[model samples]
Target: MLIDGLQCGHFNRGVFEELRAGAVSCVTITGGFWQGCIESLDAITRWRDLARENADLVVLVRDAEDIDRARAEGKTAIIVGFQNTNLFDSRIRFVELFQDLGVRVVQLTYNNQNEYGGSCYEPEDSGLSRAGKVMVREMNEHGILIDLSHVGELTSQQVIEHSDKPVAITHANPASVIPHKRNKTDKTLALLKERRGIIGCASYRNICAPEHAESAEKWAEIVARTVDLVGIDHVGIGTDRSHGHTLADMHWMRMGRWTREIDYGAGSPENPGTTAPLDWFTEVRHIGRIPGALGNIGFSPDEVEAICFGNWRRVYGEVFPGGK
Candidate 1:
């Protein structure tokens, strides 16, 4: 069964339809980018209703076994997730509250310094804070998977070193592969490999290819290269999508509540908007097309299977024990 590691979609029947068309058995959709606690709760509520509306097609995944169960039934297991830590910002206790609400993954920081730590985009990254350390331990105790996708290099290193369990870089590529800020460093990848952690090759247009090749072949090449660098068990799919979002919605991901000025992530002030995700993956069904490309690129069936969804399954079992 195919699984998308992360996506920010329009969230409706149309999205679920795309997911099924892609033959996705499990997925982790964004519940927040930079939303506060109340907004995040509202986002979860909205998505809960939407998932329930399409109950026949998908179910909210709260455990490792839910993924297999959904796939067995020919349905997609939707894992509600977060991309930033500000929802619980200063309140360490809120991590459990959000976990109770079905948030399986939480990126420690977004694009700048937060209560947790510095972001990759920051010019002077101070790394993880005192509060950030507490948050990590708290999340560990509660089994919330820590995501370091948008976190600073130093901070990402710290989290990987600090967490007793394996963490996930749910969506990000190797910076050597693509020089984007969102991409990670060799040091971080080394630590990740040491921890037997997992990473998702982000399919966001700018991060994947500056020229926007956006083909299944191009994406397959990226994944293969990443696997070569970090080993097979650590890579998966996290095709960041904006299939049905508006310009404003895209802008919101770039500029959250903290920024009064327009923050053009992976874009410029002149070109203040990020491009579409991937040309080949405009429809969710396009994810099903990746395995064949992998096969073409000399990825063995087992390796391809690991990249497709197996690694993520292993991560789920490692991070979320006993249904979390």
Candidate 2:
């Protein structure tokens, strides 16, 4: 049951074929970021069309059972997600609407602050707002897993304390390991584990140590350190793989209509482009090799299974709840 907790692939028949080749049982793919309701709906429609066209390779996942079904049928399960709450703005009712549309996970904030709360890139961390609290409750009631991968520290902590259900840091690493703002601190990770939450170790290079960006062994070390910090039950994989995307797509993600100028995230003036791909995992199919890497890093077979998929399955089951 290999699962990727987060990815932003441009899914088509070829990409779906790659997922099959990788033996991925399930994957959570982004549906929108900084998109209004109409655009978000259009994105969802496109995803649905893709799944329909590639039904032989993938199926839309509405709950944890769908993940198991996909694996049993040898097809990859697709969980549509959003990296921002921009789709609905202040309209809390859209939570249930999107859930009905097959969106299973959503991040509170993206790279910048919004009505929900501050983001990792924001200067001051304004904790979750009143509207944010309402939104969180709505999502809980509706069975949508809250994600804090790009949210700021203060807001992330408040969300962890406020939400009745356990949340997820879907695609971020430990700040102590890489010292990136996008990564979580040791204190936050401890709090997440205390709440029985899960953290998906992201394979994105910008949030990882520079020397380790291309080394599977070093990356596995990062995963081992996270497992040591928060037991294997709370750890999983989120490759953040953007296969089939180009530099233009990267620019759109970073500067999503917020700034007129190009915002090179984790990059500088000299190298104003997308971050380098991981040497070991330049494509989605390469994710299949991660289990071996984890095993080589002293993880037992059971532990490897947990990190690869079982842990995500547990969290998704708790949040999705028998498909509601």
Candidate 3:
């Protein structure tokens, strides 16, 4: 079974059915990005509606048992997760509230600095404030997995050092592979492995060089290298699929009230709002390409299974309450 470790897509019945057809057992849906508490609530409500309206194809996840049941029924489980806690906004207590509301993962910062810490894009990276430290403990206590996908280097390091439990950089590539700003560094990856943490290699093209934009073969090689570097037990795919979204949605994701000026987030000023997903991974049904390619690249059957599914399930079990 496949588990997309992180996703921010335009969901609909077609997408849900594609996941089922692709044998995706679960998808950790993005519950909040730059949106606030009220907006977050609205998004959650919409996801609830998706689960209700499409019960035959998809269901919302509240615990690990939900994943197992969904898999058994050949339905995809949608686990609510936050890419950033901008919604929690000034209330430490909201962390627990959101957890109760079914948020299983959260990143402390986004592309820019927040009240808690600096972003990966910020010019000056403030590691973590006193409040951010509080959040680390709060999330650990409340069972919300701490994610460092778009956090600044110092903040990510601090998070790895501070958290008593293992944390995840859920949808980031290794900087060693692509050398992008959002990718994790060698030191951070090593520390995370030492602490028994999880890291999911992303397939977003901005993390890769321009020439390899549509290469699934290269994407598979990237995943294999990640496993070789971090060990298969600690790696999986957080492919960052954004299928079926329009320019308006991309603008909101890139600009997000933080700026009035337009920013070409994916490095193509000529093509402002587009992200390049590999040709073979443009949809959920194409997920088999990565794992299939791994089998040809010297991974044993057990190791391929671990990279595609078992590894993520193991991490979810360790971090989320009742996780399988």
Model 3: pairs clashing at backbone N, Cα or C within 3 Å: none
What ranking of all candidate models by TM-score puts the best one first?
2, 1, 3
Q: Please give, for residues 213-238, the per-residue lDDT of candidate 1 as tens digits.
A: 55788778889888889998889988
Query: Which is the better candidate, 1 or 2, if ranked by lDDT?
Result: 2
lDDT of 2: 0.88
Candidate 2 worst ten-residue window by lDDT: 209-218
Candidate 1: stretches off by over 4 Å:
210-214
lDDT of 3 by residue, 1-324 (tens): 788889886889988878877788888888767899999989888988888999989888777778888889988988898888887878999988888888888888988898889888888899988999999999988888899999998888888899887888889888898897889888888888887788887877778655445556667777877876888789887878876777888888878998999876655576666775776676668876776777877888998888888877777777787565
The global C-alpha lDDT for each of the candidates, from Candidate 1 onward, is 0.84, 0.88, 0.82
Task: Estimate the TM-score of every prediction.
Answer: 0.96, 0.97, 0.95
**Better model by TM-score: candidate 2 vs candidate 3:** 2
- Model 2 per-residue lDDT tens digits across residues 1-324: 588889995778888888889889999999977888999999999998989998999999988899988999999999999999987756888888989998899999999988889899888999999989998999999899999999999999999988998899999899988898899998889889988899999888878876666667778888998988998889998888887778888888889888998787756687687776788877768888888888887999999999998999999998984652
Among these predictions, the greatest TM-score belongs to 2
lDDT of 3: 0.82
Order of candidate numbers by lDDT, starting with the best: 2, 1, 3
